[model samples]
Target: MLMDAFVDILRTIIWPLAIVWVSYIFRNELRGLLNRLSLFKYKDLEAKFEKELLEVEKEAKEAEKLLDRSLPHIADNEQEKIEQLLRIAGISPRAAIMEAWREVECALNDVAKQEGIRVKGLVGNSLSADKLAQIRGIPRENTDIYTRLKYLRNQAAHVPDYVIEEREARRYVQLAIHLAGVFRLKPNE
Candidate 1:
């Protein structure tokens, strides 16, 4: 039984890792060769596009930072105070929070149509490493944040009577801040 189990793991995990390692070793050479191909003669244009793409990414990152700083991780207790923060920050606090969580989910889609890093879940599902990376210029290493927020969002939505308590809200704020930092976003000024 042990030998069979070992063989199964070798087939599923070890083989895949070996393939990826080989591909990574040749990644740079592949890029250079692709540039030399007749169909890819416009490599110079590609380089220029990369630069412009990077600039747009930077601008988006700035917007994210502005929003993160303006919105408190620990939103106040009063509805009026929350509204005031939203107004001052030029955002809808509830909407922004919900949307941010959704965005993280969509990042795993295969249809992003951009070349950048991506995070994969345990099932090998893809997430957009680009939107977050372009905005924050950081990579996602751990896969915990996605699962945790997803659980919370589901719980809140599924149970009509379940209200997010103050304690839960505070944790969300802290989680967002920690995630922002993971993506290399500095705490707002």
Candidate 2:
């Protein structure tokens, strides 16, 4: 008797959820049916669903744009890349700093390669800033900047609540440019 009661309770809960899921999946069909029968009664429901759908699409597009803009522009000639990062900084300092740090990491990696420094990471992968600094044998001051950049990048990437100031972002962009110059890598036009 207990087993039967439990089964009946499960069925009661499951059927509604299953119906709602199917209705959601076949919303188009439901809309058409509603249109054909008792049209006035369901008009409000249809309008509400359509409004929610439009909002979801708008949010998806904005998310796509943000992701595209946040990627580091390493291939852009150095000046252009810095400009792009600065522009992003104007809107989102965290994205700007993270992008600038990526450029710095790429510059450091290139220098390591040109100098024949063996990074500890696997082949074809860039080394972490600290590991790259060790391989390059940079001075203590340089090491400090590299470590700081690494910290900022980590926070920006992993912490949703992390914030960066515009001034700090600009400083990081300049530092990345300076470091690239030190490596003698010309930013391509």
Candidate 3:
């Protein structure tokens, strides 16, 4: 058995060596053939790379449009409301809190829309704030902020007598602004 195995190994080695000898004997022809094959491979690789690059460029353009769409557009009236809320944050903390949450929701909806998340449907939107955070590849800390903002919004909207402090409301607004920035969508002041 050992002799047979040795013979098999020698046979394999001999075939390779014979191929090498043949190649050496026809070195010029082999070289030309190899050069042609390499050139073909290079051309194919280059074409594939160019195709991939075009795809990347197309995706980049689409991404730019998506980012533009994600930007929150504060209408003149909405900006006025924000200014009013900021001015009276102390006097009407609840209203300011509600407004801040609403702004966050608005930003979330805009981002969701840009992400192609349908809002109205039987399935509802998969790109809620949580899913958006994941899709945007946000850090855990920032995702936590998103979760907190959503919680606060839910509380202010659905929960009864959810009195939000001015400080907390301000923080929510800051988080909303941060979320907007995550998608390269700076809210127009």
- Ranking of all predicted structures according to TM-score, beginning with the best and ending with the worst: 2, 3, 1
- Measured by lDDT, the strongest candidate is 2
Q: Residue 168 in model 1: shift from native, Å?
A: 1.4
Off by over 4 Å in 1: 1-141, 184-189
Rank candidates, lDDT, best first: 2, 3, 1
In candidate 2 the C-alpha lDDT for residue 42 amounts to: 39
Q: How many clashing residue pairs, candidate 3?
A: 0
lDDT of 2 by residue, 26-66 (tens): 99999988755653443453344334334433543443343
**What local lDDT does model 3 show for residue 2?**
100
Per-model lDDT: 0.44, 0.56, 0.55
Instruction: Let me know the TM-score candidate 2 reaches against the reference structure.
Output: 0.45
Task: Give the runs in model 2 whose Cα sits over 4 Å from its true position.
Answer: 1-76, 118-138, 183-189
Better of 1 and 2 by TM-score: 2
Candidate 3 residue 146 C-alpha distance from true site, Å: 1.7
* Candidate 3, lDDT over the whole model: 0.55
| Residue 85 local lDDT, model 2 | 82
